[model samples]
Target chain A: MFSGSVWKNIAVLGIVALISGITVFTVHAITKGYIIKSESRYAKRFLFQVAPNANYTNDILTDTINIPKKYFSMLGIESGEIHLVKINGKLISIIVPSIAYDGYNGKIKILVGINLDGSIVSVRVVSHKETQELGDKMEVVKSDWILNFNKKSLNNLEPKSWKVKKYGGYFDQFTGATITPSAIIKQVHETLKYYEMDKSRIIKELDVFNEIKVSNNFEGGN
Target chain B: MYIRSYKSILNNGIWEENQGLILFLGLCPLIAVSNSVVKALGLSIATMFVLLFSNITISLIKKRVSGILKIPIFIIIIATFTTIIELFMKVFMYELYILLGIFIPLIIVNGLILNRAEIFACKNSVVKSAFDGLIFGMGFSAVLITLSAVREILSVGKIFINMDLLFGSAAVDWSITIFSEGYSFLLFMLPPGAFILLGFLIALKNLIDGKVNTLSGNERSSLKKETKRVRTTGPVA
Candidate 1:
């Protein structure tokens, strides 16, 4: 209660804090629109690549893939679920944005679209914090060998079958990127596992993704 | 406050008082975004604009600002101007804005701005501060553009022409080609390449300076010794 003048110090600090806060808020407001557009552009390639067989119009991220209300109960976001792409009244590829956390560095985000029979349409790396030369070679410009993954089936695929040739397995690792290719193979196997485990429910849930936006809007409004 | 001629002004930017290669200000963005010519150019232009405007404003208000609160007042003024340029980039060059990222916000830390505020802005008239800023901006841009050109040519195998995204239709075809076929030196675009190219560029600058010095009867001074002899600063390209 009898200190030397805390009020003066508090007032100065308060003014500085207020000014700094306002400046940050203003900078964010000024940059928000551009940042959103740029991020969307970066992510759009993933959706389109993974679902090449499907026709998408407008900003794809804004549109959602609808899971059937009947099958929605069986699927959890944290647990991973199944959904299908729907064009004007017909069904298309199944959309699967999967997180392969056991990647070379951090989680390698992959959006994989597969036909009901398990043929991959395409794959896109949404985010990956891989190693300098090894894991980063996953990019097409660097080590495009991942292109070999196309058109392969998993019916008789063995676990050991899903590994780098360095370990005497199927896939090839980058020049020095064994872990990256290995992680990719492991994640692909998991994606296939998830698809196979819930095939019947997923099959029943097909042709419902077109209504995703409507459901989302209804939920948001409430 | 008194720049006698063009040579003196050029000397101010290029040597006696440099924003980067000499002054050592703005090293953060200089290192972060020098991976390509387009990005470096985008950031250089933005910084130039901010430096020019803030110098003018600070010089105008130098007399009015109290000694007790000059730094805070100076920061407020610079931040106001920096935000304006950031908004312009966001609206007009969205792709460039995205590539520059957080480094744009970090421009507030750039010592070039503060150096001018403390040195020229606090003492000079508005017109002189503006000239100093303009020369400093040119020097910074020259270094940035040259460094980015070298990087993009070696790493990306191409230079410029993301114009549809950065400058809209007008800049389409504005990009020039340095190569004809597949000849990318990928390592040049990496962060390590930044250090390598920067080392080589500084060496080049020293070589040129040595030649100039030799012509002026100072051939005894070695270029290696010259660069090392002096403390350098931001926009280090």
Candidate 2:
């Protein structure tokens, strides 16, 4: 025969289990909608920042890109390296975010947004755990030092011009944070080098910019 | 199964078995994203969702589950709930998810969940155990959020509630600015800040516990004497 108390214990536990399960499920289901919205907004912001200054106002997350599974071998599609910018219907530019290896602390995460014609739109610091005032001052948010790297093409930046003011480059190092600024300039040089070498491949892959097609023309076209 | 008393519910969650501050569970996510208040809040809330459901599901099935296979069953239940939360996190709070990264899935390993399944859910009735799970989860999350808030405020010299973020648009700009632009204290937001704050908080809790016990000690002497007499009498000839 079963133990004297086993049945009683079972009844209590059974009720407890059912109630707990139902309540928790209820809360989770209720909050699911809010959580989804938050995630989409976050991804949208990053997508815009990481891509380019286009009105990429698609229902972004739901908007699927029909990328080939074998996209790995595609040309100008540098995998994790493509930036997309569009203006007036035609694709204006596509810059791949790359790194400059000579950062003072280490390699800085740089997202260099460029146009098809080799003109730079912007370079943002994706991340840098460098020192404050000096090293971390290299951030575009912290100072205009990063802005100086804009527009200057491969031919314009001479190797000797790569140094900071302290090191003789046009860029000024922070009054006390020379290592930080110098590192950024060095990164800028390397970023340009990467872009020069891989521009076509990167642009070809980020088809996010290709929205114009002559589909569904009216039968009464003038 | 019923809330026969209020004190038991509070005590169960607060400390006798705290999720993180005492049990040392979920330390990985607790330490990593705790660099700022906002980051910590996002993670804390996300974790609460996972813990709440997993506890309930595990408790419901405790009777049917084999004692030997209880551990794996607990894991599957916890994993399914965690995955649901993960998908929700990715779709809605993508920024928090990206920042949280591996730590989100690591919730599967949070001793807090396992401990709840092994200790509370499997034994207690559904209603009682669900409250226990919530209370414990909240207590642990409360500690995490508070610690991260302290660290963030000191390090950055600001509190960005971004209420619209976790709450909704209504809470946007709800953040109270404690210190002006230049007042930010950098050290508090770093890794060292976490250890320093954790150590101080532990010391503070211990001190309070000691003080409260001392104040109540006189009334407990008679009870202690009875227990002491039983202990001392047992082994004596």
Candidate 3:
């Protein structure tokens, strides 16, 4: 159903595409396993960064609870994951990998690890599209601005005091970039509040899920 | 098609026709990632792989490609090579991959690759195109490394803080602190600093070219003697 010249063009392009596609597919297949291993290892390291001193007996990588869609919108994500950290079969903290949609340029993905008592263990910006010099100060690599969130949570400060100083709150904003820090502070506080409200339900679900999975693996082995 | 000497091609790309400095083809990553040598080197290697592979592939298929469909074919081929390089780096050099970020994928749009593909590769033999691409890619990497060194020293007061990102853990101590840790001029790390430094680099290239030309018996009048004459009588500031 094509003209002669068009057919020739299509055939040539098709051959090129097929060759390139096969090359990419082969390379991808070769690296697939390694990529998965390294990525999971990297993810584990990131978890350790968020939940410092995590002495988990269970595999934290597999011990994750996918946050329900109802709560994802509140944290600016369609879906989310809350990694469960357990030490000697007792839960210590839950790390929430969240997204802040109010960033100056675009969405800022963050990981917030909260202690059992609702205090923050650590906060890390996983990825952000903030301006290079100004807004980038929020990055822990650039400045210690993010460290200010450590050990502070909803209980320590009033709801109104959770904003950058420019907005009459405690956190310090960057010299020229106020929006980035302010947005992060606001979103982090929201994430903390979400944790507070659903703390019991989420923790209970993780515990039951872990018990069932452990029992299933035990039965399967037998 | 011009069929210049291979030695001239090498010299042209390295000095006279530098893709970065002389031609100013790819400046986005040059300015953005040149804050440190490791980041620059990461991108440099990735770009070199893409350029070399794209050139050779394009040259191989040039005769078969139709006139009207050439651009699309060239772009698709370049993008394929860039994706391969990106995926390879993501697997082996994960940290550097993260550091390079969007610039890795953005290599597809880098004018240097497409420019070389269209202008030189399409008209040349596979071997010649491969050599041209290699020389051109090296020229880009050289400029990137120099810019990175200057910026890293000026801004972070260190030469190669994260050489471990490119090299393994053994090279972690390769970083040399030039001016103590806290002593840095932030201007050199910003985007404007890139523009200023790039301007100086271009000027330096021009100055060297001028000297070389004069030494080779191509005499020109001094800048002072070539000033534009003014007809109006006024105080010359």
Clashing pairs in 3: none
Candidate 1: list runs displaced more than 4 Å. Answer: A1-39, A57-59, A65-84, A100-107, A129-137, A141-144, A156-158, A198-222, B1-7, B81-96, B153-193, B217-237
lDDT for each candidate structure: 0.69, 0.66, 0.86
Span of 10 residues, lowest total lDDT, candidate 2 chain B: B1-10
Where does model 2 exceed 4 Å of error? A1-78, A102-107, A127-145, A154-157, A172-183, A194-222, B1-6, B161-180, B183-187, B221-237
The interface RMSD value for candidate 3 stands at 2.2
For candidate 3, lDDT tens digit of each residue in A1-222?
A: 787999888888888889889988998899888888877876776678877584668787787877877888788887767888888877889888788887889899899989989899899998887866567887777799999999998889999999888888999988887888888898899889889888989878877877998999999999
Best-first order by TM-score: 3, 2, 1
How much is the lDDT of residue B110 in candidate 2?
A: 88
Q: How close is every model to the real structure, measured as TM-score?
A: 0.72, 0.72, 0.84
Look at candidate 2 and tell me the lDDT of residue B114: 86
Candidates 1 and 3 compared: the better one by TM-score is 3
Measured against the true chain A, the candidates' chain A TM-scores are 0.72, 0.62, 0.85
Deviation of model 1 at B95, angstroms: 4.5
Model 1: chain A TM-score against the true structure: 0.72
Model 1 agreement with the true structure over B100-207: per-residue lDDT tens digits: 889787777788888877777678878778888888888877777787788877775678846566667778777677787545565776677877887787778778
DockQ of each: 0.13, 0.19, 0.36
